[model samples]
Target: MPHFAATLRTGLCATVLATALLGLAGCVVISPFGGHDDQLRETTVQGDGDSKILWLPISGFISDAPSRQAFGLVQQQSTLATVTRALDKAEKDDDIGAVVLRINSPGGTVSAADEIHARIQRYHETTGVPVIASFGGVAASGGYYVAMAADTVIAQPTSITGSIGVIIPSVNAKGLLDKLGVEDASYVSAEHKDIMSPLREASPQERRIVQDVIDSLFARFVSVVKAGRPNLDSNHLAEITDGRIFAADDAKRLGLIDRIGHIDDVLALARDKAGVDEARVIRYYRGRSAPRSILAEAATGSGMNFSAAGVPIDLSVDSNAGASQPLYLWQPPGAP
Candidate 1:
């Protein structure tokens, strides 16, 4: 135990020294050994054939901004950036039979999701490659938005999707501030510069402006869904677009999803659609070790979060980092 403690101390000291040296030199370095170069290495998941199927995963918070990891020592590439890189790589490979997107997320910022959706749509149009979306646990709001780009969508039996809507989260801290005798006294140039300020109740005019913005975004969301799902019963359009979630069965029935199936089933459909009898399932990743199987994720550490006093430091940042950033998200109360 003593030897282990000494080793740990030495490692910490070395990290501190390196950090200091780099800071003094006005240079930022993620790792001394290697860094992310946006170069993706392919790891075959399963099967053996001349053609290949790319198993791309769209998981967690879909953000365009790069995520900080290893206590900001490493920058995990953004989901948008990764998608761009993956599609770029896939387009160059002629042997690529099809692209299967494994989506599992509650959703994120409107801009990020919309941008990814647009890119995928453009990719399919340009390459003529069949894009299939396979929903996992949850594919709500922005998650569903990106799936619009897919030629076909297959959801697991227990998958939860829909929640087709827009949201701009804001907090009202006026009551809390009153209890603490704190006041908001910031100066602004315009009459409604602080439109969604939490310090005070918004005027009717401000409320109207915010509602107008929401309505505009909602209209866009509906339009995107219409373009994606042509067979969707127009009669049920009002019911489906009421910001409610739907199960896999309901989604399929509502024409939001095409079929319900497992990963293997999705793969088979993909291979059949691409007219390939046999094909290797591949995953593109940026890391040192290769994934042992399709389900295995990269070994990239999220990052250490311990302070000198052994207290956990909150180093993570949410996609909604501002006061009133608009989103196409489906984050319910108590959701992570």
Candidate 2:
């Protein structure tokens, strides 16, 4: 059955590839790294007569996940490593006059968001280039946190733009385990070592300790927001930072965003701030080299395409499995 399933998958991939080639003639199948070079060259041509406005996208979940190419698949959107490299390149490019951070995210882990925020701040400090954050459909929690580093933030009128707080989720399956007649024999050096273990209920002391950590992190989040938005009224600070999501209009009213505008508006703002009448706009793409094992896998003619648009089959082990970590993330009610 396993062999049959593998054969079926191979046949399906071959059919899909044939269909794509027939339907999309003249399409170039560039390697992931080659695509980045192609895009860079195209943008260089576009900027021949003007300064450049680099559009760096911050899409999907913002995490410090290692490069997806290490798993032999092109990552679709921003990861910390790729985003940092893009900013570094932009900072060194003399033709790049400004940066427009196109943010479309519901946020991710706390440390990852903080790292990206600091990188953006450093880019601005070193280059003196204007940074405009253009919020997309949703930019909540850590998404909004990173945007705070931008000199100006613009959100669409319908954009969901706030959810300022921290959350550390841990599942407790003690009841389920008991129902299944399963007993966990996990051992640790300290009582709090396995405090987040799903097989057992957290003790009151453990709960208190975790709550204290959350409180401290929440206070730090508030301080960062305050520093970024000094003009925000103190009266509305508590309400705005209470982990409630806000629409763009309410966000602007509460001083969470600078304006209600779209990507085009952000482009104009970037141009004006950079003192350039005309500027070429470009976005960065990941330039990851595929491993020899991946190349060998492709050589098998297994009818698989390890491209960005292709579904990834992660063969690498996840380091964060079963771990409880703090997040600056926002999930709408009913979200899984």
Who wins the TM-score comparison?
1
TM per prediction: 0.88, 0.78
Q: Candidate 1: global Cα-lDDT?
A: 0.85
Model 2 off-target regions past 4 Å?
A: 1-48, 67-78, 287-323
For candidate 2, write residues 220-304 as lDDT tens digits: 8899899888877789988999999999988988898889987668878988998888887765542232113201111111122
Report the C-alpha lDDT of model 1 over 238-269, residue by residue, as the tens digit: 99999999998889888999999998899999
lDDT of each: 0.85, 0.74
Provide C-alpha RMSD values for all models, in order. 4.1, 9.0
Clash pairs, model 1 backbone: none
